[model samples]
Target: MTLVFSTCCFSPFPPLHPGRLTVLPQEALVQIGGSIQLNCSLDCPDGTPQWKGLDTNLGNIISTPTYSLLLITNATVAMEGTKFCVGNCQGKSHQGSTNLQVYSLPDTLQLETQPKELVAGQPAHLHCSISKVYPPGSLTLSWYRGDQRLESPDAEEVADDEELFSYDSELEVPGEKVTEGMEFRCEVELLLPPSDRSFHRATAVTVSTKGKSWRSELGILARWVCNFSCQSHFPMSLAILVCQG
Candidate 1:
């Protein structure tokens, strides 16, 4: 690899030795809320390296006679950028930089099913929603039923707020496949493990085929309620009840 060096000079530092200055890990990729340290060392002690950035929030800096260090504790997405350590090298300014990138996962995953109850031979709509995701356009959402992959809607992304995103994956089920006791789920995939905010990535909702028929069950429930309504304090007409599948 071809190695190129830069010369940077400032009035505050004395003339530096004509030698090499190396900054470990020229680039850094860290998770949000994580910490990282960038080290800059000079071959000769004639000059001291200092860390600086256009933004003060880039992090804290520590300097010693031996080396200069940039410490970013509790790093946030806003702090991702290039930081520099420059010193006067042989009457010229020599510089090194650290490129930092921050990443995070969605805060919560949710699954929604249309007409909460699923019946055999009934068409149903299921949707998976991901909220508070960072670094948009890096998400892939897929749908699954048990061990089988289901035909899912194209995952869509939306800007929820500045620097935050929301995603949705929709799946439409044909009535023939609609059956009770089948679990459907959605997952948000990440490129690496220890992903930021990644947890219980999937949401599963079971399909139900309870009750012989929706029409009959509603009639039966209504009749059963009215049978004792006159005797009961609450009138059946004024009472509302939800049937369990």
Candidate 2:
């Protein structure tokens, strides 16, 4: 009996498996002085994952068997960029990336009225200013009156620099439209990528008609009180008393 010689070829290392790679927060909006964490995960247990496009010295990184974490503290404009995660599974390379948008938003909005005295039938101006905002190009200014949008002015050009900047916007209102106890609002919007954030400041002005006497002003005040009383559903007698007084 003749036995045919058979030979089998085998390798000591197990076959490599291809697995899915995922990165969380594909797009992030990190406010100035805030922090963010990004995660990179791999399904293939044999894969080695690493971070790219990140300064290891600036941020902290945590590595585990199946995932990696990147922590950014005190995010600022310098940290705005794309970050990548590269993984090798079964000798094949895979990459996942996330976009970081670091922005500075004004903590407060200031609204000021030109000319201490607001008079009816004359043009008046409202100035809105927001300070310490980064990426001023993405900023927008809007004027509103009681939920009514009066106008949206284009953002003025500002010098691009590492330091934060300030912006000013002005609105001119016809005196005829300015009434006693009129509320004007200035809204600031940061049109950042992924989503937009906004803040607003409002001021109420007491306007007097041109050439109006003190008695007329007092009457206007009384009428305002009466209107408030009526709107509050106070007793009709109280409303009448407010106007009479």
TM-scores for all candidates: the values are 0.64, 0.70
Error of 1 at 112 (Å): 1.3
lDDT (10s digit) by residue, model 1, range 92-129: 66788867767677556888888777666788888788
List ranges where model 1 is wrong by over 4 Å: 1-20, 25-27, 88-93, 117-120, 192-200, 209-245
What is the Å distance of residue 162 in model 2 from its true position? 2.9
lDDT of 2 by residue, 1-245 (tens): 99976546666677666567889887776888899999998878867677886776658999886788889899877888888998877677889988888777755777778766776556788787777787657777777765678965764645546678778888889877776655677777777655565444344455554546766787998888788876797677867876887
Worst 10 residues of 1 by lDDT: 191-200
Each model's number of backbone clashes? Answer: 6, 0
